[model samples]
Target: MAVNQMKNRMQALGLLDRSFKAASDDDLGDALERLDDEHREALESFVDEVSVDGVRAGVRTGRIDGGMEAIAAIVTDAALADTIEQLGDHAESPSSEQLREVLPGVVERHRLGVTRIMLAGTVVGEAPASAIIRDLLKNDETLALPPAPEVEIAPLLDTSKRSSDEQAELRAKRKAAKAAKKDAERARRAQSAAARGR
Candidate 1:
């Protein structure tokens, strides 16, 4: 929960590409404006109580755990429920592509808890964000499907050189072979039935 540790967790959760060193007042104000009433209130309280210098001092003295308690309180089960509802409204079966499109907004809204759950790797039991992410990954895996094994149908049917009569002859031969095989199967079944009766 130290600043560095929190940063590491965020990175692991794909929440942060780079560490956040400092925020300008304008940057902070813009971030606050995006938050809901509860989260904004908690963040505002933290901002009110702690200055940049105060945070630096706290980090120096090892007093603050990166305001994790406040973050945890803000990102509650209710907040996660709201996120789930929002995601549901966004898509019925959220594809990875679709999720990626909307994920930034969702993460921006539920940053802390989503990061926490992603780091923990718990889906469904923890936050719905993790479950949503897991489902998207699963959908991606299903959709990938290994390109259908590159079936060599061209080799299987190389009739470009053959004449129409040759092709018709080949088709007739295949039909005859199929009929012969079916007759053999039927004969084998009749023999088996005779043996069973005896």
Candidate 2:
């Protein structure tokens, strides 16, 4: 496959290694941790969809039993799970064993990077590229790192900035307003009492 074509395929499979490398693992982990149950399920489903067992089945037999058997078989085969986990989305969809067989060199070339990045992301507790990309699409900031120190901060005199005197003056005004309200209430009560006496 051409470079552009391979990149496009990799992206469709959801392994953007460059973005994964640039992202902080802590940020990604926090984001994954914060996922609602539904999104967590979706992430798991997505992972299964791209798993090596899923892919190897898709590639070898084109999901002849509609993938259920493949999924079941994967549970028992550590080797297949490891391979699928390494292959990620590259193992899924239209690219079958025949396709790879037909264009072994091209298919291998595209799959190399996809497998490498997926393997790298699966190191221990780090967030996988697939999960991070899914959360990122929903505009979740959990995968985002804190702002860099070099980033330009707002000026110290922004709208919320207030001097000590200004705060004191505001407090005094509030106090005066409270006093005036109390005086008004006293006057009204005195008027009511006087009218009652008459």
Candidate 3:
């Protein structure tokens, strides 16, 4: 058989399994250190060959789509939150100008991907960043999470107005209602059973 066919036959028969072994971190490091200069240089070159676009594309694979407000929370503090509040209805979304002003600081500080910078600017400031922010936001390759979900809040109950006696009465009424419901259910079941028997 040809050498290629012979190697394929060996692989099919599991002989290739003996050619590789899992190594511990220390053992791998020692092996690398022991390599000759030429071999080490080749490995370094392979590492250096990774491109920014490749990294960015990899990050984009996990990108999530949502409103910008969450992005703002990650990159901004109380001052920025207050700034957003001051914008009133406009605060619902960040403007491009706000993004231009704030995104560089956010990107530099957080090491976020370009989409996050865009989101932070629009969500927190109600605008997208200018070219300045866009430029700064590019070339980043870090993985990022989706924004926080908006929570629905209910108004607090004012219990101070109710007297102790009234509170006790309310609890008693609730207990009575629950007992009545159980009695009514039992009666309904009894009627069904009687009808079936007849």
Candidate 4:
């Protein structure tokens, strides 16, 4: 819906038409599974709470599940509930086994910089990639490390001056090609309408 809205707004402003291709429905579904950092923290907090509560309540096996249920219970307001419902679509209203398969990958993706819920709707398609991210997140505490000093970043890669100029030249060429394509499309439309009248 947001993609369609963006395209429609662009068309209305005469910026572009429906020339952009989006990830397919299945890709979107996969992305829905790849939520961000705040979301992972939210789920983990729920798990921890459930673990604590289960210890107090003497429930033996379901601390994690109970914690999640408890967190769900806390989001009772209208706006939060709406957001929850939208995000729950990631759970995909499917079998437990599928959820189990996807949840670890989602958690792994969260550990990376992919923190926006909006982008999650795009990255979930590459399950293998997500799984690798998850494994790295699981085994590597580097994600848990302190932020590096900005001064240390310059030494990591060789600085190159030609890269930006070459990219700018390529961008200019692409813009020219796109303008010609749009002009041709407009001409075709006008010719087709004229032919219909004749």
Candidate 5:
């Protein structure tokens, strides 16, 4: 993909946000740690997508040394050897430049390891990519989702003990209501088309 397209995708994924860029390592770590399971899953999935896209782009541009096989070998080798973790300590905050260098490797290792085990039937005794990335970056300062809004749900009817005849009558009424709703919707659409034509 084009550079602009990749950049746009990153922005849409919240990878290029100013808040994330400006956030301190400690702040990032705290934010990441606080994420609920749902948010954590989302973050991991997004990271994997971004990592794969980055690799593909590198391959297309001839920036990366080889095809995916070579990339996988490099990541797997690094993961098995524990070089990625040794690159930096979990407690030490890495600079953005350092993160740029290390994030891809971490993501690729996790993704390929899982794929190898599940699809290729090869065992990969490696830690999850999210864990590695969390350890390395210690950042999630701007990724929190807002609390869900409260909702009140009320039942429209209580039909626990309705007779067969009553049930049939209720079904007929529902069918008629649905048909009426569809007619109203069609009329509204026709009016909208007529207005647009004018």
Candidate 6:
């Protein structure tokens, strides 16, 4: 039905069914007469494949639960839902540029997730938490994402924001480490001088 609606064609191929007690003589005759030899064989093959006893032969099958629920979750996210709707519009199906503009907002705002970079210009910043994203792009593979946005390539990635106190603390820690190292070096020089005098 989905394919039919998309392609504007009736699914005539779905008319055949073989599950029944038994067909009457008239019904059997009509079934044989309605379909051509090839179609009859095709229908027979389909029926045989679907038959529980026949289907289990020469084939392995496994059951999956929550498959549809997983699909539903992806479709339900605000950004994902919007993208699907945009794609469905057909007339104004967002172009590459639109997808680019849309994705950043979706990631930063709606998705509340950091992306590759936050540009303050000249100085490139943080990278993704996932090494997989970095490696994939590093190898110069065309990502299977929707399209390339008008993005600045120089900004490597976006990191979580740091407040003033956090920055100050980091600087203080670095300065303390440097002073400690310098004092250790001075002590080592004084000990050498004392040993040489002795």
The backbone clash count of each candidate, in order, is 0, 1, 11, 3, 4, 4
RMSD of 3: 29.7
Highest TM-score scorer: 1
lDDT of each: 0.43, 0.38, 0.38, 0.34, 0.38, 0.32
Distance (Å) between predicted and true CA of 157, model 2? 67
Task: Compose the digit string of candidate 1's lDDT tens values, residues 112-171.
Answer: 324333223333223335555544433443211122234466557677999999999999
Candidate 4's TM-score reads 0.21
TM-score of each: 0.29, 0.21, 0.21, 0.21, 0.26, 0.20
User: Which residue runs does candidate 6 get wrong by more than 4 Å?
Assistant: 1-75, 82-92, 112-198
**Residue clash pairs of candidate 1:** none
Pairs of residues at least 3 apart in sequence or in different chains that clash in candidate 4 = 30-124, 31-120, 50-67
Candidate 5 residue-wise lDDT, 1-198, digit = tens = 699766543432231122223334443343344445655443342233324344333223221111222233332342333434644663244444554465456435433222221111111112234333323222433222222345789868779789999999999999999999788767755653553354
Once fitted onto the true fold, the runs of candidate 2 whose alpha carbons sit more than 4 angstroms away are 1-15, 46-198
Q: After superposition, how far is residue 125 of candidate 5 from its true place, in Å?
A: 43
**What is candidate 2's lDDT per residue for 96-131, written digit by digit as tens?**
342223223422432332323333233211233434
Clashing pairs in 6: 116-157, 116-158, 117-157, 126-157
Task: In angstroms, give how far residue 170 of model 3 lies from its true place.
Answer: 0.2
Per-residue C-alpha lDDT of model 4 across residues 1-198, encoded as one tens digit per residue: 999766543332211000001123333233324435555344343333323232223212222223212222222122223333444755333333443454445435332222222122112222223433333333434322122235544454453555988878978999999999788767755653553354
Pick by lDDT: which candidate is best?
Answer: 1
TM-score of 1: 0.29
User: Residue-wise lDDT of candidate 6 within 1-198, one digit each (tens)?
Assistant: 777453321111010011111123333233334445554443333233323332222011110121112211221233454544544653144444444444555444322111211110001111121233333223322322222235666865343577888889988999999999788767755653453354
